[model samples]
Target: MTVKKILGAAAGALGLMWVVRAAWGIPSAIGASMSAIQPYASGAVSYRDRHFHNTEPGSQIVAGSARSLLYSALTRRNAGHPRGVIPLQTPVVPTEAADLAVTWYGHASALIEVDGYRILADPVWSDRVSPSAIIGPTRMHPVPSPLSDLPPVDAVIISHDHYDHLDKATIRSLVAAQTAPFLVPIGIGAHLRHWGVPEHRIVELDWGGSVSLAALGRTREGTDLVLTCTEARHFSGRGLVRNTTLWASWSIVGATRRAYFGGDTGYTKAFAEAGTALGPFDLTLLPIGAYDERWADVHMNPEEAVRAHADLCVGDPGHGLLVPIHWATFNLAFHGWSEPVHRMVEAARAAGTAVAVPVPGQRVDPNGLSPRDSWWEDVG
Candidate 1:
């Protein structure tokens, strides 16, 4: 073929690829729209002005010059990524759930075991946490394990509807791989329904609402496991319009043990309130990344995570095993890759808080907690 014809054919192929990529999975990935989600969200007390509002007014982004922000975005594309390969561990899933343990599956995804019941929290096994697979913040490290590798869970807990925490692809996989019901904040069930998740598998709850494992027909030795939808200081959206659904933290209560999963949030007094109402948690998995001065109201830094842990422990910092989540998996902010864990370790040390910094996919049993190791330093 002539060079001109070859070039023309190549260009045509490129155009077709771009179109196919953009159209594939984008619409479904955006989840339920505002009108579709309203019926589920409107009755909640936090719903107002056609959107869900935080108890304490919070800003997603603080005022700043657009030009400078744009410049920084363009210039510091690699600011949040690590300098070396992020190490991964093959998850050690036991034949039966432990009394109290957690498996960090990167980002906000974790498997929590309490009182012999296995609960999966925010399991996003997708490579990209965005509506479009061709674009957006890709995973810094590959998912430690595939969805198929996970054992049958008693329940699945989702904190919010953000892409990172509530993924369409992962939810679809979970529906097929496991029979666990998804207990989520109000209106997130709409998204699940939109994605073809059966109604029986979706449980929606407002802040302070809860459901028991026995009620869901999953019981262990006749012991009940309670999952509560607690408050969080964050916003939720899958597209341009925001907060059509509620965002939240989760309180996992078993017969003899309690744990808190702070999916993603900034500092909030609600932590103290949760501690008083349903805490004195034995294990706390909290966010300690994706924080910036511009959006300080929504994302907590390491110090704030430590404070949140303390608050959940009812001001007793030395109470529980604090496991840092929301970092080391994806690049979603402007801070250094390992900055959050470094600061968290320092804060925990000063506050006398017990912390476990696990590599992606590593499991931690609060009963037999190990000393902290600087596993992330070489990678970052």
Candidate 2:
């Protein structure tokens, strides 16, 4: 064959190899098959008619048709992206987890410290939040810190089975790097099991279920950190099959301090219910992004997040520190990249709530928080 023909053939082979590799990752990325997940999910109160239902009656997408949503997503691809480079901070992880501190790792990933126990929540370190690595909402900024750099955590908690929140690659990496148990919502353990996570490492819970950190055999002596799977008005699915698993918020209660992680959810009265049952939290890491009127039933807008924070704080709006999550890391919605924080701050101020807007990887001790700054204004 001539030189040009040989070159073309070699290029074609390389392209074919790349395609094959990408395709191979898709199945695992989509996580446990519906059949594999059913047994673990079937018994939950939320599970009926072969799918999980939200406590409140609502659709994930309320205002727009799928085709219209798709068209807008395609046309306004850059609408959610930041105008400037997203600033990142290298986290300064202490030798011991603090009594009440949290390190925001962008998107929905956060490492929360409550009463000297570290809990990593909804950690998604992958480049894209889609089943296909090459085609999805790619991270606008690189992970602020590598997963290998994380301290030995008491538990790794997942709020749902969505790709952005419950990543397969990150779970696999954690399985190899950390000895912590995986605390996930019902049916999520099947995905963990499918990802080769040892059965001993998986602990599945339905809403209102509680597991002691000591019971998991990972906590320090006399530590009484109880992780409760609290209610969240959200849906879950990694692929075409939706809500095969339960979606939830998490309440981390220590002997003295408490924290609530509203992984991803719409506004729901369940926030008050959680506060009554497991909260009056000292710190709340709630989602304040990926919201749109079209999908408002599933995602909370900035103002709703403020309201949720107060509700989680047992109706005392100024009770605790509120650090925003689920924004600034990915262009998942059509709003301006900085809009969530801006609106969140305004609503928080109006409600007498204390708020902390940390840059990715910046750790905040809710006890000794600094004055709020407009770091996002310069970035976007």
Which candidate gets the maximum lDDT versus the true structure? 1
How well does candidate 1 match the true structure in TM-score terms?
0.96
Tens digits of per-residue lDDT for model 2 on 1-380?
99999999999999998898677779878888899999888889888999999989888887447888888878886888988989899998999888999999999999999998999999999999888867778999999988999999989999998889988889999999999999999999999999999999999999999999888776676777999999899898888878899999999999999999999999999999999988898999899999988888889999999999899899999998999999999888888899999999999999999999989989998767543789898888
How do all models score by TM-score?
A: 0.96, 0.94
Task: Report the backbone clash tally of model 1.
Answer: 0
Residue-pair clashes per candidate: 0, 0
After superposing candidate 1, which stretches have Cα over 4 Å from the reference?
1-13
List per-candidate RMSD values in Å.
1.7, 2.2
lDDT of each: 0.91, 0.90
**Candidate 2 regions with alpha-carbon error over 4 angstroms:** 1-21
